[model samples]
Target: MDVWDLNLRHLLAVARIVEFGTVSAAATAVNLSQPAVTQALSRLEGQIGMPLFDRRHDGMVPTVAALLLAPRIDAAMARMSSPYVTMSRLRALLALADVGSYAGASHVTGLSVPSIHRAVADLGTAMRRKLVERRGRAVALTEAGVQVVNAFRLAKVELETGLSEVAALNGQETRSIAVGAMPLSRARILPRAVTHFIRRYPMVKLGIAEGARPELVEPLRHGALDMMIGALRDPLLEEDLVQIPLFDDVPAVIARAGHPLAGTAPDRRELARYGWVVPPRGTPLRESFERHFAEVGIEMPKVPIESGSVMTLREILIDSDFLTLLSPDQVSVELEAGWLIQLGALPPELGRTIGLTCRASWRPTEVQRAFIEELAEASAGLPGALHPDLSPLLG
Candidate 1:
């Protein structure tokens, strides 16, 4: 069929009729009269050279041709909606630019007044224009309003093209890479790597999920995740997975600055005197901590608090006397702020290797490889021993 002969209005009418099951309902949806909707449908069917609906006493039912055409017509409608969506967004931004008062724009656009105000303020800063004139409670657009709107229109077009390019890229890949990491790593490392990867090859989409080691390992084995980066627990390493060591991170006992152990190097026995903040018992970190204590001929302290969230652990350490063992990277900010102090490091062998773990059969995609490269670069900049394979990736 010659799809070029079909117009958006005709497609929309057909889609609505198919959805609502009646010409009258379709007309109501499009704010057109029933006769106008029927005319559009008639025009559409004429172009396609097939009757789309089988007229029934109860309601119009879609024929085989109609069912086949429905998906194409729906896709056409979605494509047409893209321009309108951009226009609507630009209009909202323009409305904010006109009224320096976000509250006023919010009332007009049904957005929070402060949000409208912030958008206007940000746009003004970005454009270096006084787009709005504020006279008491009233707001008005300045002479620059026309120029700003025109520029925004051009920007909207560019954005739409960029989005289309990205969408096209994602559709090219039959499979996607699922990456799992600790939340801290997600915040600090993943964003830049993801951005770089997406920009270079828009077709490969990375599905990123964050969880603790215990939660991430099963997903990696079950083929739910392509690979994971976090502390590789001994049990997880023992499984049928290949571990590529990234870097070794020394575990340190962290506590608030004013805590009694802040400047003191507490012996293993003294370490057991305080309340401990530990991860759930089954976690690699918890197991490592227990094993280390046992090796030193000391009893493991009963943990007073248990949590898996790094942020929660950080906050608890900052505000309370409770001490917890954490990767140095996790507590770097707190250490810099004087909110936390590292009492002492774990024994050298107690340091865990943060690495990439994947099923032995799993193959890394180009995007994943690039991300791993970026990670290696970041790791190499740190003052520590680097894994041999990581050196080449860093270069």
Candidate 2:
């Protein structure tokens, strides 16, 4: 199921054969001989353990496997951008781009340092452009190099997706989705969706990468994650990303069960008197925390610690007078265990919107779409909706 195992040029030949209808023409289009193209097709069919074309007296007739794989190959080739992008050169550049030195690239790829160095050099010469530039002791990609890297990454995504799709057709069930889980999403929505999703798709694996937005966003953009789920930033800064709002999460003032504010519903002024533990300043929760006081026309409280870790926030709040603004879903276990209590709820207007964030250009496979549907169903009633006044408004 590894895209690297399959020849990239041969994959292109498969698409060309699908397009041109004969090995002779596909060979001409790819600038290879007819025998080579025929051999490539035979190799592909052998590797996939399925015929790509029906040999006929008149011409090559595309099979279901060819039809299924051709578009994915075409999409991948389109992203590859240049005909000079061989698998070896592509791997070398990506490895060097990732680790920043020929020695590091060699270590990552297990290729000899000279091999990686020569491959990258050949790639630059083939493209007639500078890809990497030395800066003092370090090296970095040029703007053109960054663009090429992005294209290669996306092309890899397309090829991998095609490989998974073909594997599924053969009943191999290699399809998988890599997801970036923001804190709130992992706390509730992601778990619920994943449980429902796997019941219907037991063979498809889900790799969940949990992190805050800043940590996960780059991977999401680089085609490393199929999607990210959590708070949707207002006026979302990334033009390449598309957000689908699942619901609004109205945060609450959370304190220990027997804290001074536990017995009573405190006003903003009273809540602001004690020290607070909140997410970093720029995050949605912290902005809402600031608004929690601003809404009541009170000065902000002193923040002794800034973190997004539920465990850290829970421990500090339990042991001290510090309070934090959080969705009830984020600390449901502690609340049920009598370790924490929702001291007061922020007005629904000041709440954060939770949802899915995915690359704008992504075309998800069937299983990925099904997972999204499961997410939507789970969002129909969220833990944040447990608050009396705010109901989940599903998108």
**Largest lDDT belongs to which candidate?**
2
Model 2: residue 16 alpha-carbon error in angstroms: 2.3
Residue pairs whose backbone atoms clash in candidate 2 = none
Give the Cα lDDT of each candidate.
Answer: 0.65, 0.85
TM-scores for every candidate against the unseen true structure: 0.51, 0.91
Instruction: Let me know the TM-score candidate 1 reaches against the reference structure.
Output: 0.51
**Winner by TM-score:** 2
Write candidate 2's Cα lDDT for 124-229 as tens digits. Answer: 8888889999998777999989988988898899888877888888899999999999888888778889999999999999999989999999898889999998
Q: Mind giving the per-residue lDDT tens digits that candidate 1 earns over 1-395?
A: 32223454556667788888998998887778988888888876665555789989888998765654555545434432332323334555656655556665677777776666566555566557666777787776778755565445433332322223323333434324578887545644566667766776676657988888778877666456767877666655364677766667677788888998766778888888888887888766787688768987877887978886878988887777788888767767778988888888888777776667766644343455677876666555544536438432323
Q: Give the TM-score of candidate 2.
A: 0.91
Cα shift from native, residue 33, model 1 (Å): 54
* C-alpha RMSD for every candidate: 16.4, 3.8
Alpha-carbon RMSD, candidate 1: 16.4
Q: In order, how many clashes per candidate?
A: 2, 0
